[model samples]
Target: MIIKIAEIEEEVVFSGIICADRFKSDYENVDFFGPVEYSLKIGRSDKRLSVKGHVQCSLNLLCARCLESFRYEIDSDIDLQLLPREMAPTDIDLELERDELDVRYYDQDEIDLTELIEEEVILNIPMRAICKEDCKGLCEKCGGNKNLNECKCESGRDTRMAQLLRSYLEEEGDGHGGSQEKAIKVKKG
Candidate 1:
């Protein structure tokens, strides 16, 4: 949905439901099977356009641990300042002020709500998603999903430590020459 700045007089309030399917191409990795309800108030103060809104949606995300798909709901608050390209500073080396973090520059007179919604949805997703707090994840050895089924692979020793111990025991005559010879003979026997 594109909001034309020219259409607005001084201030306007808009509220509608945007189909989540519209953002399917934007978020190819995740699935959105719900509508995004949004209510925004756009007002112009001098050359700056202030936008405040609320967006809510549901998403189907894959659990990072068990690799199972689950539904997750998102409700995000939108507070932004839209500045014209000419008013924005051109210096890339300059540090941004604290308030400038939420400021977005617009090259054209229209603002694309689709891009904004996509960004908010992606940002709201957790860094690491798990189906449950006690999710048992997959078995490293047998590649079995531990949450669903148990595996026979040994789970006590760390794989890295076991590899190191095996490498040390297989080394030929590393200081304990006689002990190494006896160990090799016992293995063959």
Candidate 2:
């Protein structure tokens, strides 16, 4: 939905649900259960626009580690300032002030609420989706979901440090005929 700047007298309030299918093309991996819901109050002060609202949705996602399907909830607060696209800096390397972090740009006469809603939903998605905090994930050897069932494969220990220590012990033994046990005790002390 596009909000025309000319139509706003002072402020406009909108609340509605956006269908999940609307985002299917861009986010194929994520399955939206409930439609995206929003409640926004967009106020205009001359040419400047301030948007304050809330956006929420339920997303069906696969856990990154175990690959199990899980439902994730997204609840985000929207507080942004919108300015004309012309106000955006032409220099790519230009630094932005702290207050400008929440600023967005709209084209000539309109603001695309649909695009803004999509961006909010996308931003709420977690970088790493985990079903649980202590999820064991998949077993490497058996290729089984460790959260569901424990595998019988031997626990693999990282041996790089052990290998380096062994090499060091061999070098010391060659130089001074020192016992491996004595060298280990000296190194520990």
TM-score of each: 0.70, 0.76
TM-score of 2: 0.76
Q: How many backbone clashes does candidate 1 have?
A: 0
* Tens digit of per-residue lDDT, candidate 2, span 16-135: 999989787776468888799999999999888999998988877777668888887777789998988888776655426624568888897799998898898877766556566556
Using TM-score as the measure, the top candidate is: 2
Q: State model 1's lDDT.
A: 0.69
lDDT of 2 at 13: 92
Native RMSD of candidate 1 (Å) = 15.7
In model 1, which range of ten residues has the least summed lDDT? 180-189
- 88-121: candidate 1 lDDT, tens digit per residue: 7756644276245688877788888777766876
Look at candidate 1 and give me any clashing residue pairs: none
Give the CA lDDT, 0 to 100, for residue 95 in model 2: 26
